[model samples]
Target: MRFFSQRRRPFLSVVICIHDMAREAPRTILSACCPYQKNVSPEDYEVIVVDNGSAVPFALRDGAGLSPAPRIVSMPHPRPSPVFALNWAARHVARGNHILFAIDGARIFSDQLIANTLRAHSICTDAFVYTLGCHLGPSVQMVSTTQGYNEDVEDRLIAESGWPAKPSALYNISVFAGSSSNGFWKPIVESNAFSVPRQLLDKMGGFHESFASSGGGLANLEIFARYVQRPDAKNVCLLSDMTFHQVHGGVATSAKVQHSTFAQEYFSIFQREYRFPSFDAIYLGPLRPEAAKFARIGLAE
Candidate 1:
Protein backbone atom coordinates (compact mmCIF):
# COMPACT_ATOMS: atom_id res chain seq x y z
CA MET A 1 0.00 0.00 0.00
CA ARG A 2 1.34 3.38 -1.04
CA PHE A 3 1.13 6.10 1.61
CA PHE A 4 2.05 9.03 -0.64
CA SER A 5 0.86 10.20 -4.01
CA GLN A 6 1.29 13.63 -5.59
CA ARG A 7 0.24 14.97 -9.00
CA ARG A 8 3.65 16.47 -9.64
CA ARG A 9 7.03 15.00 -8.80
CA PRO A 10 8.42 16.07 -5.45
CA PHE A 11 11.39 18.45 -5.31
CA LEU A 12 13.26 16.20 -2.89
CA SER A 13 13.24 12.48 -2.09
CA VAL A 14 14.36 11.52 1.43
CA VAL A 15 15.81 8.03 1.69
CA ILE A 16 16.10 6.59 5.21
CA CYS A 17 17.54 3.13 5.96
CA ILE A 18 16.52 1.16 9.03
CA HIS A 19 17.57 -2.11 10.61
CA ASP A 20 15.76 -3.44 13.70
CA MET A 21 14.62 0.03 14.80
CA ALA A 22 10.95 -0.78 15.46
CA ARG A 23 10.93 1.19 18.70
CA GLU A 24 12.69 4.22 17.25
CA ALA A 25 11.40 4.35 13.65
CA PRO A 26 8.09 6.03 14.46
CA ARG A 27 9.67 9.06 16.12
CA THR A 28 12.23 9.32 13.35
CA ILE A 29 9.51 9.24 10.69
CA LEU A 30 7.44 11.86 12.49
CA SER A 31 10.43 14.17 12.77
CA ALA A 32 10.79 14.03 9.00
CA CYS A 33 7.07 14.27 8.13
CA CYS A 34 4.57 17.11 8.12
CA PRO A 35 3.70 19.21 11.20
CA TYR A 36 6.95 18.22 12.92
CA GLN A 37 8.88 19.60 9.94
CA LYS A 38 7.98 23.27 9.83
CA ASN A 39 7.36 25.44 6.77
CA VAL A 40 7.38 22.58 4.29
CA SER A 41 4.27 21.13 2.70
CA PRO A 42 3.72 17.40 2.25
CA GLU A 43 4.00 17.85 -1.49
CA ASP A 44 7.47 19.33 -1.25
CA TYR A 45 9.15 16.02 -0.55
CA GLU A 46 8.62 12.24 -0.32
CA VAL A 47 10.20 9.95 2.27
CA ILE A 48 11.27 6.43 1.28
CA VAL A 49 12.26 4.19 4.20
CA VAL A 50 14.12 0.97 3.44
CA ASP A 51 13.87 -1.70 6.07
CA ASN A 52 17.08 -3.64 5.67
CA GLY A 53 15.85 -7.07 6.69
CA SER A 54 14.96 -6.59 10.30
CA ALA A 55 13.80 -9.56 12.38
CA VAL A 56 10.47 -7.77 12.84
CA PRO A 57 9.83 -5.87 9.61
CA PHE A 58 8.68 -2.26 9.71
CA ALA A 59 5.07 -1.75 8.66
CA LEU A 60 2.99 1.02 7.07
CA ARG A 61 1.24 1.66 10.41
CA ASP A 62 4.54 2.89 11.80
CA GLY A 63 3.94 6.04 9.77
CA ALA A 64 0.13 5.91 9.86
CA GLY A 65 -1.88 9.18 9.78
CA LEU A 66 1.11 11.12 8.55
CA SER A 67 0.52 13.12 5.37
CA PRO A 68 2.99 11.93 2.79
CA ALA A 69 3.48 8.94 5.04
CA PRO A 70 6.78 7.26 4.36
CA ARG A 71 6.79 4.55 1.73
CA ILE A 72 8.39 1.61 3.56
CA VAL A 73 10.27 -0.91 1.43
CA SER A 74 11.44 -4.13 3.04
CA MET A 75 14.35 -6.13 1.74
CA PRO A 76 13.70 -9.89 1.77
CA HIS A 77 17.32 -10.92 1.65
CA PRO A 78 19.38 -8.10 3.10
CA ARG A 79 23.10 -7.79 3.42
CA PRO A 80 25.06 -6.75 6.50
CA SER A 81 25.70 -3.38 4.86
CA PRO A 82 22.99 -0.81 4.05
CA VAL A 83 24.72 0.40 0.89
CA PHE A 84 22.86 -2.08 -1.31
CA ALA A 85 19.51 -1.07 0.16
CA LEU A 86 20.33 2.64 -0.18
CA ASN A 87 21.40 2.20 -3.78
CA TRP A 88 18.31 0.21 -4.65
CA ALA A 89 15.96 2.79 -3.14
CA ALA A 90 17.76 5.69 -4.79
CA ARG A 91 17.73 4.04 -8.20
CA HIS A 92 14.23 2.50 -8.10
CA VAL A 93 11.95 4.09 -5.52
CA ALA A 94 12.99 7.76 -5.40
CA ARG A 95 11.13 10.20 -7.68
CA GLY A 96 12.61 13.53 -6.67
CA ASN A 97 15.12 15.63 -8.59
CA HIS A 98 17.24 15.90 -5.44
CA ILE A 99 17.84 13.02 -3.03
CA LEU A 100 18.42 13.57 0.67
CA PHE A 101 19.78 10.62 2.62
CA ALA A 102 19.18 10.20 6.32
CA ILE A 103 21.08 6.91 6.10
CA ASP A 104 20.52 6.21 9.77
CA GLY A 105 16.76 6.06 10.48
CA ALA A 106 17.24 6.69 14.19
CA ARG A 107 17.84 10.44 13.72
CA ILE A 108 15.28 13.12 14.65
CA PHE A 109 15.54 16.23 12.53
CA SER A 110 15.39 19.91 13.40
CA ASP A 111 12.05 21.41 12.29
CA GLN A 112 13.44 23.77 9.65
CA LEU A 113 15.55 21.09 7.97
CA ILE A 114 13.41 20.59 4.90
CA ALA A 115 12.54 24.26 4.36
CA ASN A 116 16.12 25.44 4.77
CA THR A 117 17.38 22.67 2.52
CA LEU A 118 14.95 23.83 -0.16
CA ARG A 119 16.16 27.39 0.31
CA ALA A 120 19.76 26.21 -0.08
CA HIS A 121 18.84 24.37 -3.27
CA SER A 122 17.20 27.49 -4.61
CA ILE A 123 20.41 29.38 -3.95
CA CYS A 124 22.40 26.75 -5.81
CA THR A 125 20.64 23.80 -7.41
CA ASP A 126 23.84 21.80 -7.68
CA ALA A 127 24.78 22.40 -4.07
CA PHE A 128 25.66 19.51 -1.78
CA VAL A 129 23.64 20.49 1.28
CA TYR A 130 24.19 18.82 4.68
CA THR A 131 23.46 19.31 8.38
CA LEU A 132 25.77 18.59 11.29
CA GLY A 133 24.86 15.58 13.45
CA CYS A 134 24.41 15.45 17.22
CA HIS A 135 23.69 12.81 19.82
CA LEU A 136 20.82 13.03 22.35
CA GLY A 137 22.95 13.03 25.47
CA PRO A 138 25.77 14.82 27.27
CA SER A 139 28.23 13.34 24.81
CA VAL A 140 28.37 11.16 21.73
CA GLN A 141 26.37 7.95 22.21
CA MET A 142 29.44 5.72 22.05
CA VAL A 143 30.79 7.52 25.10
CA SER A 144 27.44 8.37 26.66
CA THR A 145 26.35 4.75 26.75
CA THR A 146 29.38 4.14 28.95
CA GLN A 147 27.88 6.82 31.21
CA GLY A 148 24.49 5.02 31.59
CA TYR A 149 22.72 6.34 28.51
CA ASN A 150 20.16 4.25 26.65
CA GLU A 151 16.87 4.46 24.78
CA ASP A 152 14.94 5.15 27.96
CA VAL A 153 17.33 7.94 28.89
CA GLU A 154 17.05 9.38 25.40
CA ASP A 155 13.25 9.34 25.59
CA ARG A 156 13.36 11.26 28.85
CA LEU A 157 15.82 13.74 27.41
CA ILE A 158 13.58 14.37 24.39
CA ALA A 159 10.53 14.71 26.59
CA GLU A 160 12.25 17.25 28.78
CA SER A 161 13.52 19.20 25.81
CA GLY A 162 9.90 20.05 24.71
CA TRP A 163 10.65 19.21 21.11
CA PRO A 164 8.25 19.49 18.18
CA ALA A 165 6.78 22.44 20.16
CA LYS A 166 10.28 23.76 20.73
CA PRO A 167 12.27 22.12 17.99
CA SER A 168 15.31 24.32 18.48
CA ALA A 169 15.61 22.94 21.99
CA LEU A 170 17.27 19.90 20.45
CA TYR A 171 20.50 21.83 20.39
CA ASN A 172 20.28 22.28 24.14
CA ILE A 173 20.13 18.55 24.79
CA SER A 174 22.51 17.31 22.11
CA VAL A 175 26.28 17.45 21.83
CA PHE A 176 27.83 17.46 18.39
CA ALA A 177 29.10 14.12 17.11
CA GLY A 178 32.87 13.73 16.82
CA SER A 179 32.63 14.08 13.07
CA SER A 180 30.81 17.39 13.48
CA SER A 181 32.47 18.60 16.70
CA ASN A 182 34.70 21.12 14.94
CA GLY A 183 31.82 23.55 14.19
CA PHE A 184 30.27 24.74 10.92
CA TRP A 185 33.36 26.58 9.60
CA LYS A 186 35.46 23.39 9.56
CA PRO A 187 34.97 20.30 7.38
CA ILE A 188 33.05 17.36 8.87
CA VAL A 189 33.93 13.75 8.29
CA GLU A 190 30.33 12.89 7.46
CA SER A 191 26.76 14.08 7.81
CA ASN A 192 23.74 12.06 8.96
CA ALA A 193 21.40 14.29 6.92
CA PHE A 194 22.58 15.45 3.51
CA SER A 195 21.13 16.15 0.06
CA VAL A 196 22.64 16.06 -3.39
CA PRO A 197 21.24 16.45 -6.87
CA ARG A 198 20.00 13.13 -8.28
CA GLN A 199 22.35 13.48 -11.21
CA LEU A 200 25.37 13.92 -8.97
CA LEU A 201 24.40 10.84 -6.97
CA ASP A 202 23.97 8.88 -10.15
CA LYS A 203 27.34 10.11 -11.37
CA MET A 204 28.98 8.79 -8.21
CA GLY A 205 26.91 5.55 -8.54
CA GLY A 206 24.76 5.99 -5.41
CA PHE A 207 27.20 4.84 -2.69
CA HIS A 208 29.66 2.05 -3.20
CA GLU A 209 28.03 -1.35 -2.74
CA SER A 210 31.32 -2.90 -1.66
CA PHE A 211 31.12 -1.30 1.79
CA ALA A 212 30.08 -4.65 3.26
CA SER A 213 30.49 -3.81 6.93
CA SER A 214 27.32 -4.08 9.02
CA GLY A 215 26.52 -0.32 8.93
CA GLY A 216 27.90 0.46 5.48
CA GLY A 217 31.29 1.09 7.09
CA LEU A 218 32.62 4.50 6.10
CA ALA A 219 30.35 4.69 3.06
CA ASN A 220 28.66 7.82 4.37
CA LEU A 221 32.02 9.55 4.72
CA GLU A 222 33.01 8.40 1.24
CA ILE A 223 29.89 9.89 -0.36
CA PHE A 224 30.36 13.21 1.46
CA ALA A 225 33.98 13.32 0.37
CA ARG A 226 33.15 12.58 -3.25
CA TYR A 227 30.43 15.24 -3.40
CA VAL A 228 32.51 17.95 -1.72
CA GLN A 229 35.62 17.22 -3.79
CA ARG A 230 33.76 17.67 -7.05
CA PRO A 231 34.64 21.03 -8.57
CA ASP A 232 31.07 21.48 -9.83
CA ALA A 233 29.43 20.66 -6.50
CA LYS A 234 28.99 23.58 -4.09
CA ASN A 235 29.08 22.20 -0.52
CA VAL A 236 26.54 23.96 1.73
CA CYS A 237 26.42 23.34 5.46
CA LEU A 238 23.17 24.24 7.26
CA LEU A 239 24.25 25.91 10.48
CA SER A 240 20.78 26.18 11.98
CA ASP A 241 19.51 22.70 11.15
CA MET A 242 20.77 19.42 12.66
CA THR A 243 19.88 15.74 13.01
CA PHE A 244 19.67 14.49 16.58
CA HIS A 245 20.54 10.81 16.89
CA GLN A 246 18.85 8.58 19.42
CA VAL A 247 20.60 5.69 21.19
CA HIS A 248 19.88 2.64 19.05
CA GLY A 249 22.83 0.28 19.60
CA GLY A 250 24.22 1.07 16.19
CA VAL A 251 27.54 -0.48 15.11
CA ALA A 252 29.43 2.78 15.43
CA THR A 253 27.31 4.70 17.90
CA SER A 254 26.77 2.02 20.53
CA ALA A 255 29.22 0.99 23.25
CA LYS A 256 30.13 -2.50 22.15
CA VAL A 257 33.44 -4.36 22.02
CA GLN A 258 33.06 -4.64 18.26
CA HIS A 259 32.88 -0.87 17.88
CA SER A 260 36.62 -0.34 17.70
CA THR A 261 37.06 -3.40 15.53
CA PHE A 262 34.46 -2.15 13.10
CA ALA A 263 36.08 1.28 13.04
CA GLN A 264 39.47 -0.15 12.12
CA GLU A 265 37.98 -2.43 9.47
CA TYR A 266 35.92 0.37 7.95
CA PHE A 267 38.83 2.78 7.91
CA SER A 268 41.06 0.21 6.27
CA ILE A 269 38.47 -0.42 3.59
CA PHE A 270 38.04 3.34 3.14
CA GLN A 271 41.79 3.92 2.82
CA ARG A 272 42.10 1.08 0.34
CA GLU A 273 39.18 2.30 -1.73
CA TYR A 274 39.40 6.10 -1.53
CA ARG A 275 41.09 9.02 0.20
CA PHE A 276 39.60 10.93 3.16
CA PRO A 277 40.19 14.62 2.53
CA SER A 278 38.95 17.64 4.49
CA PHE A 279 36.77 19.77 2.19
CA ASP A 280 35.41 23.13 3.37
CA ALA A 281 31.74 24.03 2.86
CA ILE A 282 29.77 27.18 2.05
CA TYR A 283 27.87 27.77 5.30
CA LEU A 284 24.16 28.61 4.83
CA GLY A 285 20.91 28.96 6.81
CA PRO A 286 20.02 31.46 9.54
CA LEU A 287 22.13 30.82 12.63
CA ARG A 288 19.64 30.54 15.45
CA PRO A 289 20.68 31.80 18.89
CA GLU A 290 20.17 28.32 20.30
CA ALA A 291 22.57 26.90 17.75
CA ALA A 292 25.18 29.69 17.82
CA LYS A 293 27.31 27.98 20.46
CA PHE A 294 27.61 24.81 18.42
CA ALA A 295 28.19 26.69 15.17
CA ARG A 296 31.13 28.58 16.67
CA ILE A 297 32.55 25.71 18.72
CA GLY A 298 36.15 25.63 17.47
CA LEU A 299 36.28 28.93 15.56
CA ALA A 300 38.24 30.80 18.27
CA GLU A 301 40.96 28.13 18.46
Candidate 2:
Protein backbone atom coordinates (compact mmCIF):
# COMPACT_ATOMS: atom_id res chain seq x y z
CA MET A 1 0.00 0.00 0.00
CA ARG A 2 1.55 3.31 -1.05
CA PHE A 3 1.10 6.17 1.40
CA PHE A 4 0.42 9.87 0.83
CA SER A 5 1.35 12.53 3.43
CA GLN A 6 -2.12 13.81 4.37
CA ARG A 7 -3.30 10.65 6.13
CA ARG A 8 -3.75 11.18 9.87
CA ARG A 9 -2.69 8.17 12.01
CA PRO A 10 0.10 5.93 10.85
CA PHE A 11 0.82 2.25 11.36
CA LEU A 12 4.59 2.67 11.49
CA SER A 13 6.91 5.12 13.24
CA VAL A 14 10.28 6.04 11.74
CA VAL A 15 12.88 6.57 14.48
CA ILE A 16 16.18 8.34 13.77
CA CYS A 17 18.74 7.89 16.55
CA ILE A 18 21.50 10.45 16.64
CA HIS A 19 24.72 11.08 18.60
CA ASP A 20 27.21 13.90 17.81
CA MET A 21 26.28 14.10 14.12
CA ALA A 22 28.06 16.67 11.99
CA ARG A 23 26.17 19.83 11.01
CA GLU A 24 24.99 18.63 7.64
CA ALA A 25 24.16 15.00 8.36
CA PRO A 26 20.93 15.67 10.24
CA ARG A 27 19.73 18.03 7.52
CA THR A 28 20.36 15.42 4.87
CA ILE A 29 18.30 12.90 6.80
CA LEU A 30 15.45 15.34 7.20
CA SER A 31 15.58 16.15 3.50
CA ALA A 32 15.39 12.48 2.70
CA CYS A 33 12.47 12.10 5.08
CA CYS A 34 10.52 14.99 3.50
CA PRO A 35 10.25 13.25 0.15
CA TYR A 36 9.70 10.00 2.02
CA GLN A 37 6.85 11.55 3.96
CA LYS A 38 5.33 12.78 0.74
CA ASN A 39 5.28 9.24 -0.56
CA VAL A 40 4.04 7.76 2.75
CA SER A 41 0.61 8.52 4.10
CA PRO A 42 0.88 10.33 7.44
CA GLU A 43 -2.12 8.30 8.51
CA ASP A 44 0.05 5.23 8.21
CA TYR A 45 3.31 6.53 9.74
CA GLU A 46 5.19 9.28 11.62
CA VAL A 47 8.85 10.20 12.19
CA ILE A 48 10.65 10.57 15.51
CA VAL A 49 14.11 12.10 15.74
CA VAL A 50 15.98 11.09 18.89
CA ASP A 51 18.80 13.41 19.72
CA ASN A 52 21.24 11.00 21.29
CA GLY A 53 23.38 13.53 23.09
CA SER A 54 24.83 15.26 20.08
CA ALA A 55 27.99 17.24 20.79
CA VAL A 56 26.40 20.05 18.84
CA PRO A 57 22.86 20.82 19.94
CA PHE A 58 20.16 21.13 17.25
CA ALA A 59 16.63 22.50 16.94
CA LEU A 60 14.65 19.31 17.46
CA ARG A 61 11.35 21.01 18.29
CA ASP A 62 11.63 23.52 15.44
CA GLY A 63 13.01 20.97 12.97
CA ALA A 64 15.16 23.87 11.80
CA GLY A 65 12.64 24.40 9.02
CA LEU A 66 12.65 20.81 7.81
CA SER A 67 9.40 19.67 6.13
CA PRO A 68 8.07 17.76 9.11
CA ALA A 69 8.79 18.93 12.62
CA PRO A 70 10.15 15.74 14.22
CA ARG A 71 9.10 15.16 17.79
CA ILE A 72 12.43 15.71 19.46
CA VAL A 73 13.46 14.36 22.85
CA SER A 74 16.83 15.22 24.34
CA MET A 75 18.51 12.88 26.79
CA PRO A 76 19.23 14.19 30.27
CA HIS A 77 22.78 13.03 30.01
CA PRO A 78 25.02 13.77 27.02
CA ARG A 79 26.03 10.19 26.61
CA PRO A 80 27.84 9.50 23.32
CA SER A 81 26.70 5.89 23.30
CA PRO A 82 24.11 4.95 20.62
CA VAL A 83 22.42 2.12 22.57
CA PHE A 84 21.90 4.22 25.67
CA ALA A 85 20.83 7.21 23.63
CA LEU A 86 18.32 5.19 21.60
CA ASN A 87 16.80 3.68 24.75
CA TRP A 88 16.32 7.09 26.25
CA ALA A 89 14.86 8.35 22.95
CA ALA A 90 12.35 5.47 22.63
CA ARG A 91 11.21 5.83 26.21
CA HIS A 92 10.29 9.49 25.81
CA VAL A 93 8.67 9.25 22.37
CA ALA A 94 8.02 7.05 19.28
CA ARG A 95 4.43 5.86 18.77
CA GLY A 96 3.83 3.32 16.03
CA ASN A 97 2.85 -0.32 15.55
CA HIS A 98 6.39 -0.89 14.24
CA ILE A 99 9.51 1.27 14.59
CA LEU A 100 12.04 1.70 11.80
CA PHE A 101 15.54 2.46 13.14
CA ALA A 102 17.15 4.77 10.57
CA ILE A 103 20.73 5.78 11.33
CA ASP A 104 21.56 9.41 10.49
CA GLY A 105 25.13 8.89 9.32
CA ALA A 106 25.29 6.82 6.15
CA ARG A 107 22.16 4.75 6.86
CA ILE A 108 19.77 6.58 4.55
CA PHE A 109 19.88 5.01 1.10
CA SER A 110 17.16 5.69 -1.50
CA ASP A 111 13.85 7.51 -2.03
CA GLN A 112 11.58 4.46 -2.07
CA LEU A 113 13.34 2.75 0.86
CA ILE A 114 10.46 2.66 3.34
CA ALA A 115 7.88 1.77 0.72
CA ASN A 116 10.07 -1.08 -0.49
CA THR A 117 10.64 -2.35 3.06
CA LEU A 118 6.98 -2.55 4.03
CA ARG A 119 6.21 -4.28 0.75
CA ALA A 120 8.54 -7.09 1.80
CA HIS A 121 6.98 -7.08 5.28
CA SER A 122 3.66 -8.12 3.73
CA ILE A 123 4.97 -11.63 3.06
CA CYS A 124 7.18 -12.60 6.06
CA THR A 125 6.45 -13.94 9.55
CA ASP A 126 9.18 -14.59 12.09
CA ALA A 127 10.74 -12.68 15.00
CA PHE A 128 13.33 -11.60 12.44
CA VAL A 129 13.21 -8.04 11.02
CA TYR A 130 14.08 -7.61 7.35
CA THR A 131 17.35 -5.82 6.46
CA LEU A 132 17.83 -4.84 2.79
CA GLY A 133 21.41 -4.48 1.52
CA CYS A 134 24.97 -4.77 2.84
CA HIS A 135 26.72 -2.13 0.82
CA LEU A 136 29.61 -0.41 2.63
CA GLY A 137 30.48 2.58 0.56
CA PRO A 138 31.33 6.33 0.52
CA SER A 139 29.85 8.22 3.42
CA VAL A 140 28.75 11.41 1.64
CA GLN A 141 28.12 10.44 -1.92
CA MET A 142 24.70 9.22 -3.05
CA VAL A 143 25.64 5.86 -4.50
CA SER A 144 24.18 4.82 -7.82
CA THR A 145 20.60 3.62 -7.55
CA THR A 146 20.00 0.10 -8.79
CA GLN A 147 16.57 -1.32 -9.65
CA GLY A 148 14.86 -4.70 -9.35
CA TYR A 149 14.30 -7.09 -6.42
CA ASN A 150 17.64 -6.39 -4.71
CA GLU A 151 18.42 -2.71 -3.96
CA ASP A 152 21.45 -3.18 -1.70
CA VAL A 153 24.68 -1.22 -1.91
CA GLU A 154 27.51 -3.55 -2.83
CA ASP A 155 30.55 -3.91 -0.59
CA ARG A 156 34.01 -4.85 -1.78
CA LEU A 157 34.50 -6.94 1.38
CA ILE A 158 31.69 -9.49 0.86
CA ALA A 159 33.79 -11.68 -1.40
CA GLU A 160 36.95 -11.29 0.65
CA SER A 161 35.37 -11.51 4.12
CA GLY A 162 34.28 -15.11 3.44
CA TRP A 163 31.83 -15.03 6.35
CA PRO A 164 28.29 -16.27 5.95
CA ALA A 165 25.28 -14.84 7.85
CA LYS A 166 23.73 -18.12 8.93
CA PRO A 167 21.34 -18.13 11.89
CA SER A 168 23.65 -20.32 14.00
CA ALA A 169 26.63 -18.34 12.79
CA LEU A 170 25.19 -15.13 14.29
CA TYR A 171 27.79 -15.67 16.98
CA ASN A 172 30.75 -15.51 14.59
CA ILE A 173 29.40 -13.10 12.00
CA SER A 174 30.01 -9.38 12.17
CA VAL A 175 26.89 -7.31 12.89
CA PHE A 176 28.34 -4.84 10.40
CA ALA A 177 26.62 -6.36 7.38
CA GLY A 178 25.90 -4.17 4.35
CA SER A 179 22.13 -4.59 4.68
CA SER A 180 21.90 -3.89 8.40
CA SER A 181 23.24 -0.40 7.82
CA ASN A 182 19.68 0.71 7.19
CA GLY A 183 16.49 -1.07 8.32
CA PHE A 184 12.76 -0.59 8.84
CA TRP A 185 10.79 -2.09 11.72
CA LYS A 186 8.94 -1.29 14.90
CA PRO A 187 10.60 0.40 17.86
CA ILE A 188 13.39 -1.93 19.04
CA VAL A 189 13.92 0.34 22.03
CA GLU A 190 16.11 -2.13 23.89
CA SER A 191 18.99 -1.54 21.49
CA ASN A 192 18.41 -4.76 19.60
CA ALA A 193 17.93 -4.48 15.84
CA PHE A 194 14.70 -6.49 15.82
CA SER A 195 12.15 -4.68 17.94
CA VAL A 196 10.51 -7.06 20.38
CA PRO A 197 6.85 -6.54 21.07
CA ARG A 198 5.93 -4.68 24.28
CA GLN A 199 5.45 -7.96 26.11
CA LEU A 200 8.88 -9.31 25.21
CA LEU A 201 10.59 -6.04 26.14
CA ASP A 202 9.08 -6.35 29.61
CA LYS A 203 10.07 -10.03 29.79
CA MET A 204 13.67 -9.50 28.67
CA GLY A 205 13.99 -6.49 31.02
CA GLY A 206 15.38 -4.35 28.23
CA PHE A 207 18.95 -4.38 26.89
CA HIS A 208 21.85 -5.45 29.07
CA GLU A 209 23.20 -2.46 30.98
CA SER A 210 26.61 -4.13 30.80
CA PHE A 211 26.59 -4.26 27.01
CA ALA A 212 27.53 -0.68 26.27
CA SER A 213 27.68 1.15 22.90
CA SER A 214 26.76 0.20 19.32
CA GLY A 215 28.29 -3.27 19.42
CA GLY A 216 24.99 -4.57 20.80
CA GLY A 217 24.39 -5.89 17.28
CA LEU A 218 25.77 -9.29 18.27
CA ALA A 219 23.93 -9.21 21.56
CA ASN A 220 20.80 -8.40 19.58
CA LEU A 221 21.37 -11.31 17.20
CA GLU A 222 21.69 -13.66 20.15
CA ILE A 223 18.51 -12.19 21.57
CA PHE A 224 16.70 -12.58 18.23
CA ALA A 225 17.70 -16.24 17.98
CA ARG A 226 16.69 -17.02 21.55
CA TYR A 227 13.38 -15.19 21.40
CA VAL A 228 12.29 -16.76 18.11
CA GLN A 229 13.35 -20.17 19.37
CA ARG A 230 10.25 -20.30 21.57
CA PRO A 231 7.57 -22.59 20.15
CA ASP A 232 4.82 -20.05 20.73
CA ALA A 233 6.63 -17.16 19.03
CA LYS A 234 7.83 -17.59 15.47
CA ASN A 235 7.03 -14.10 14.17
CA VAL A 236 10.62 -13.10 13.35
CA CYS A 237 11.12 -12.40 9.66
CA LEU A 238 14.05 -11.42 7.42
CA LEU A 239 13.09 -9.41 4.28
CA SER A 240 16.24 -9.27 2.21
CA ASP A 241 14.75 -7.48 -0.78
CA MET A 242 13.60 -4.25 0.87
CA THR A 243 16.67 -3.01 2.72
CA PHE A 244 20.08 -1.48 1.85
CA HIS A 245 23.07 -0.59 4.06
CA GLN A 246 25.70 2.08 3.56
CA VAL A 247 28.83 2.08 5.70
CA HIS A 248 30.09 5.60 6.39
CA GLY A 249 33.77 6.11 5.62
CA GLY A 250 34.27 9.29 7.61
CA VAL A 251 35.94 7.62 10.59
CA ALA A 252 39.23 5.87 10.07
CA THR A 253 40.13 2.51 11.68
CA SER A 254 42.64 4.03 14.14
CA ALA A 255 39.94 6.47 15.19
CA LYS A 256 37.64 3.59 16.15
CA VAL A 257 39.22 2.54 19.45
CA GLN A 258 35.84 2.41 21.20
CA HIS A 259 34.05 0.49 18.41
CA SER A 260 36.97 -1.95 18.34
CA THR A 261 36.34 -2.67 22.01
CA PHE A 262 32.79 -3.66 21.15
CA ALA A 263 34.12 -5.83 18.30
CA GLN A 264 36.42 -7.58 20.74
CA GLU A 265 33.58 -8.14 23.17
CA TYR A 266 31.40 -9.54 20.38
CA PHE A 267 34.10 -12.02 19.36
CA SER A 268 34.21 -13.19 22.96
CA ILE A 269 30.45 -13.63 22.94
CA PHE A 270 30.77 -15.56 19.68
CA GLN A 271 33.31 -17.92 21.23
CA ARG A 272 31.03 -18.67 24.18
CA GLU A 273 28.04 -19.43 21.96
CA TYR A 274 29.80 -21.44 19.29
CA ARG A 275 32.44 -24.19 19.49
CA PHE A 276 34.04 -23.25 16.24
CA PRO A 277 37.58 -24.39 15.44
CA SER A 278 40.37 -22.24 16.80
CA PHE A 279 39.75 -18.62 15.72
CA ASP A 280 42.71 -18.78 13.37
CA ALA A 281 41.67 -22.20 12.12
CA ILE A 282 38.18 -21.00 11.20
CA TYR A 283 39.14 -17.63 9.78
CA LEU A 284 39.26 -17.56 6.00
CA GLY A 285 42.37 -15.39 6.20
CA PRO A 286 44.67 -13.84 8.81
CA LEU A 287 43.14 -12.89 12.16
CA ARG A 288 44.54 -9.99 14.13
CA PRO A 289 46.08 -11.00 17.48
CA GLU A 290 43.97 -8.47 19.39
CA ALA A 291 40.88 -9.81 17.69
CA ALA A 292 41.95 -13.34 18.58
CA LYS A 293 42.64 -12.32 22.20
CA PHE A 294 39.12 -10.99 22.72
CA ALA A 295 37.69 -14.31 21.58
CA ARG A 296 40.07 -16.02 24.03
CA ILE A 297 38.79 -13.81 26.83
CA GLY A 298 35.24 -14.89 26.05
CA LEU A 299 36.40 -18.51 26.18
CA ALA A 300 38.15 -17.96 29.51
CA GLU A 301 34.98 -16.44 30.90
Clash count per candidate: 0, 28
Which sections of candidate 2 miss by over 4 Å? Answer: 1-9, 31-34, 37-39, 60-68, 103-105, 116-127, 136-200, 203-206, 213-255, 258-260, 263-301
Candidate 1, run of 10 with poorest lDDT: 1-10
Over 1-301, each residue of candidate 1 has an lDDT whose tens digit, in order, gives: 2223343568999999999998778888988888888888889899989999998888856456676778889865689889888877877788888889988999988888989898899899788999999988999888889989998988888888887678888889999998788778877788999998876776665677667888877788887888888776588999799998989998888744364565576667656544555776788867889898797788788
lDDT of 2 by residue, 1-301 (tens): 1111332334455666655544434433553355433355445555676666666765643355444456656667754345555555444455554455554333433344444334434444223243333233332123322221111333333334331221112122223232233222321211222443333444544333444544244444434444544445534333322222333432221134454565566566555542111110011112233123222432333
Q: Which residues of candidate 1, in runs, are more than 4 Å off?
A: 1-8, 60-65, 257-275
Estimate the TM-score for candidate 2. Answer: 0.54
Report the CA-based lDDT of candidate 2 relative to the real structure: 0.40
The lDDT, on a scale of 0 to 1, for candidate 1 is 0.82
Using lDDT as the measure, the top candidate is 1
